[model samples]
Target: MYTRLGVVEYPEIDTHRTTRLFTTDFNNTFILFLQLICFSGSLTKSSLLEAVRMLATYRVHRLPVIDPISLDPVGVLTPKRILRFLWHHGQDIFQPSHCIKTPKQLNIGTWKGIHVVYPHTPLIDCLDILLNMGVSSVPVVEHLTLRVIDAYCRCDAMNIAMQNEDFKLKINVKQALEFKTFATDRACAVIVSEAESFYKVICKLVETNVHRAFIINCSSVIRGIVSISDVMKAVVLEPGSHLNSYCISHRRFAEFLFETPTMETQAEEVDNEDTKTSCTSRSSSRTLS
Candidate 1:
């Protein structure tokens, strides 16, 4: 109707608005990131060698150790650290024939000083966690696509909260800018596609740590979301479904803050990657190939 009335699209605004970290809220959050990890393996569980493999093969930043009994996180290991250690201090690398004679069994609970977060929290919250805790991604309840997550905004809720008398006084210019500095990415949604292979989607996820990937039917409606949580949980709890169960190094995933752009890309890539199906209701069931 607006088009019929001779109105055109917003001509003045720019489309490449989100990618600039300086322009988006993500730029500020980068300061809070204590360290960019580059290592593999934990002290309690998962071998140093296998941890190295996960980092090298999967292209992740780090690998954390989990306790054998409780499956709790313990220590942080990064790819760079591992490579440095291996390259500089080659003599002490963990080898089966070297000394791991007893074959120790461990899980999550036995470790110490680990950080985590639920998936639903905003990406800004995730940044807060990273800044305050000196740790990378928290464990999220689900997986999400960056494209879908970009569609939502943090200010949308802030506007409602600010209307109260008490709240009105709180939003100063500093706070206003801080409040405005939030993700504009679409909220992660589920899609169903004619996807034939589970591994292919999972591979894409490993590279991105997205929330959910959908498999669709012919009608272009959502069939299911292959969430990161689903894939990771299955890897940890149900090994058979996981292809390279041994490779994942330290993973920083769950972010309470809204997601911002990590990749250096143009607008078309983001537009196409976002699933066509939108506003999907939360579903408890997960689809596997």
Candidate 2:
């Protein structure tokens, strides 16, 4: 009746504590509400650590690589990218003594941009973007600077609908975000360099309890991102364990088609009803006996 992933509450920062604004829809799905921005880099251990901490606290799955000086959008960080990096390097990653090329060493080509929306974009329009792109959130960027100012996730939409209940799609994104008092400490984006090691990356993520890290080159150019799933795959492949079975625990739920009561149970209920009716009739016929 419940999913394994859903059963175990994943460890994440309490949204209530992290931000002033929170919203939900009638179905209880968390709508993308808060635009807390966190960024990390692939170069420096300190930079990566801070980035991971912010991502985990904000519950973001991925982040865009942005230049600090220029504030331009660059590449993105994700779980799959991290996995590939580990696959190429192997157990050498675990060895403390070995020094490897930091993520900055790898050239991620020209920073291809990801999908983004504007702050004033209508909720209905952004919703369409989410559905069309099949993305959980869309970065709200400054049109001219290409700076990522905020983010809108499906969770926020869900929460907004919960609060509004009217399902007004015409509202602007800023209006939807009005539930909270917006503030920022530093530039929201996390920046990292290419000189950091995989050892540091893993530690930063584990310590910060985040899922993804973005990479940047020394030039402050965006490289790419890494994710927790990527690291796990690397670990699994190292032990010669089959990746197929890693997902086997998920099959337990699929085996049962329906968990509702069986036809036999329904029949039993009918039979009990009949017995009760007969008893009532017999009592009435006997009067006060």
Per-residue C-alpha lDDT of model 1 across residues 40-109, encoded as one tens digit per residue = 2233544554554454445445565654334466776664454345434653433332232211111211
Candidate 2 per-residue lDDT over residues 1-289, each given as its tens digit: 1001111231321221211221112111211321221122221223332343444455456655544334355666554455445545554646443236453343221234455566666665676666675455555655555444556666566654355334344566767766532332212333345467755666555554444444455654334444464455344433334322211121222222123256336545655656655555445434311
Among all windows of ten consecutive residues in candidate 2, which has the lowest summed lDDT?
1-10
What lDDT is obtained when candidate 1 is compared to the true structure? Answer: 0.36
TM-score of each: 0.27, 0.42
Model 1 residue 234 lDDT score: 31
